[model samples]
Target: MARGRRLMARDGVRPSYDPAGPDQALRAALQDLRTGRWMAMRALLADTTQWWRWTQRTQILAAAAAGTDVVRAWLAEEPGNVHAAVMHARVLVERALRARRERHRRTHELWIEAWDAAQSATATAPRDPVPWVCLLALAQLDPEQRWEEHRAAAPEPMLPPGPWGLLAEAGRRDPDNREAHHRMLQFLYVRGGSGRLAEAAGYAQWAAGQAPPGAAAHLLPLYVRVERYRRDSGHDAALDLHWVGDEAAREARRGLHSWFENTQRAERSLSDLNHLAHALWGSLQFSDASRVFEAIGPYFTPPPWMYRTPDRERAVEIFVQARDRCRAAADG
Candidate 1:
């Protein structure tokens, strides 16, 4: 039997549900924005120092909204608004990514606009990591414009040499910036080939190892597994717990358990929890998976879940089915 199936057959793992408070706050903020309460969203973004957390939530929200009028208005009112500029750039990048899926020819143009906006934001707020994170994301989307080529082309460069350098700069600004590392992992993944995947896994392992205990970076390996599965077998392949080697699997499980021990559910990102829940389900730790499912509630991030099935409705169905099965096993 597969490792997950074997694990599922054994019982005794208890389930615990603790909703991440910060995630809840983010959700609330998003809801407020959706309802036209600009003050709440403005206050959320006004904290330039809290860029890491706000940026992550903002990008997720921007992707979901698919419109940037409010954010654009904020930028228009305060042209020097670093937060607004970064978010606008993120929204453009998000749209560009979506367009790429439809084979839109203007995807590159959107990316360029995002890059320019990100550059402006970085220049305006040299100390903030959010703009750098945005730039790193743009670099990933448009690999041709990474540090090396940009350096060779520009007489004077404001940003660092490449995506690696951009990531390093973002880390320097905020050492434990979850979004920066996530973007780096993504950049590595898109730069395809087995060697890059291995490197990505190594990076994930290293990041997880270096992160403070209970941080969301612990799920990096799980993200790598999803990417690897997609690359190797395409989207429709069976979800394999053994996508990584045995040793890597052990490390991921160890990291997941560590995260579970240290994490406060209400403070964790939905994406992080979703990734953990998916990983647990894949590993056949149904009880543990059930706990994460409860914490996640109804919110679903595209990433690891959507990778299983590109169709949104289908992805939700798969998630609900897996979640139900895991809950049933835990209850039994």
Candidate 2:
């Protein structure tokens, strides 16, 4: 077992939170962005055709580019280029979000700039859903839903009013967009209250129920589950039952059958896979969990695992123990 652990470490079997995950092209693109080159980014975005992949790639690229002027340079070099224009919006939005996180004095000003850029991106790429998704992302900064469009009515009575108009616009361009729904859920989280969590859970169920098989929207409930756990005061004592409960098991199995089984190996979201793997492991579904662990390979998103324990090292220990147990079960 010690030998196996050493081999695993040497083979890079430990979990990582690399944004690029297994996407070598995206990793290279990020490297290029850091070096003040935009060509690689342009090529990467150009090749991303699927709406879900486009949202994921743009988000990762935007975060990487927000710290630099590469995206602005891209816009300057290719004035009127729709892709560059959209990417410029992405970078602006990311910067605005970072500013908000840091409580920068210019948060409001930056938010307006992001909103304008995102609104412009919609014109630049009328058929693309990403710009609308960007708008949805920014909606979190406005907890009151001050903008009339931001306070649009929910589709169902139980759900609260939110930035549903922005969500609808994204859906219009690309129905059941995964990131868009997740962004909405984040907005619900920002409006923190006991009731808001209930709203988020309801919204997750609604989104998951409406999505087609294999849609990333199926992962929504698992995210809400984690959010609930994170907010629970007595989580330590209730942790085991919280995960292995009937509802948790149902959510895990539903996501496995609907999302994992239906998604192609290359197209799966690393974060989604991590959440599914965590959910299944927590629910004591080791046999099914092992398949997800194998699918995850060396990548890790720390949030799901980190929630298991307050001690960061202990969290990693839990992750390793679960992974090894799953692997051992599979070996039989």
Candidate 3:
């Protein structure tokens, strides 16, 4: 068993597979998961779709159970695999902080390095909006350096439209493909700074406008960020609480919390958690932010020694302790 594989041994919940093979099954793969059957999934890994779904499960199930290292190796085989990068990073960040809280500095460093690799993975797929969005989320990480780099880009020709440009244009075409709308939001966000940031907000509002009654699920989060920004800028976060409005807001809050609580899908989990914590910190939820911030610090916090380690788990914990102490001192 690997270092992290020991996580799943608890309660003897073994991974199981269905009565489906790679080709012969229509939807047999979706069969319910039964415990004490880790051998079932072995053949399934040879396929792609099955692999993808398995990826999700392996991450969530394995990580929550504590088989984080197993998840890491699984993700490693698929380098440049965005999903893997995201999932693995989430675990590294979380476990790192947990380690740090326990004062296991050496182990924490191991995880932070993993988190950075995942963060930089987004840059590998520069053409993809997802990666750029990842970078944007990290803008505050090295604001002076990153902003300077973005600013220093050579003025390349306004070349023929790329996918990102097309997505931007599509928003104007129908002004309604929720996806295109988000694509535009991503573009403006990656562009960074106040002007582009506001433009992203505009696109988000446009998305809200186009979302049908079914759009509330997606719209609420957009609105929350918009609301948060508005509040920060002294604008109003509409306190209106209609039945739909209240429900949407409530669900959005829960969804975000659930995202943070998740152990797998490392990159996304870490990213979302970091964003939530920062948002919480900004909102003065010091204690809540402190816990979350500690949970994934080495990856998210701005520090050199933090970025130096391979055991991201250990690095994160150190970050947590330092941050909490700093916060404590500030409060004191």
For model 1, give the 10-residue run with minimal summed lDDT.
Answer: 151-160
User: Model 2 off-target regions past 4 Å?
Assistant: 1-12, 192-195, 233-236
- Residue-wise C-alpha lDDT for candidate 3, range 104-165, written one tens digit per residue: 85653744464475456545533333323323323322223333422333212322112333
Candidate 3, residue 302: the lDDT equals 26
Best-fitting candidate, measured by lDDT?
2
- How many residue pairs clash in model 1? 9
Window of ten residues with lowest summed lDDT in model 2: 3-12
lDDT of 1 by residue, 212-285 (tens): 87777787888887777777555444547454357545654765677766876545777777788887777777
Task: Compute the lDDT of residue 330 as modeled in candidate 1.
Answer: 83
Sequence-dependent TM-score of model 2: 0.94
Q: Once model 1 is optimally superposed onto the true structure by TM-score, how far is the C-alpha of residue 173 displaced, in angstroms?
A: 1.7
| Cα lDDT, model 1, residue 283 | 73
- Each prediction's whole-model lDDT (CA): 0.67, 0.87, 0.39
Report how far residue 302 has shifted in candidate 2, in Å.
1.1
Scored against the true structure, residue 245 in model 2 reaches a CA lDDT of 90
Ranking by lDDT: 2, 1, 3
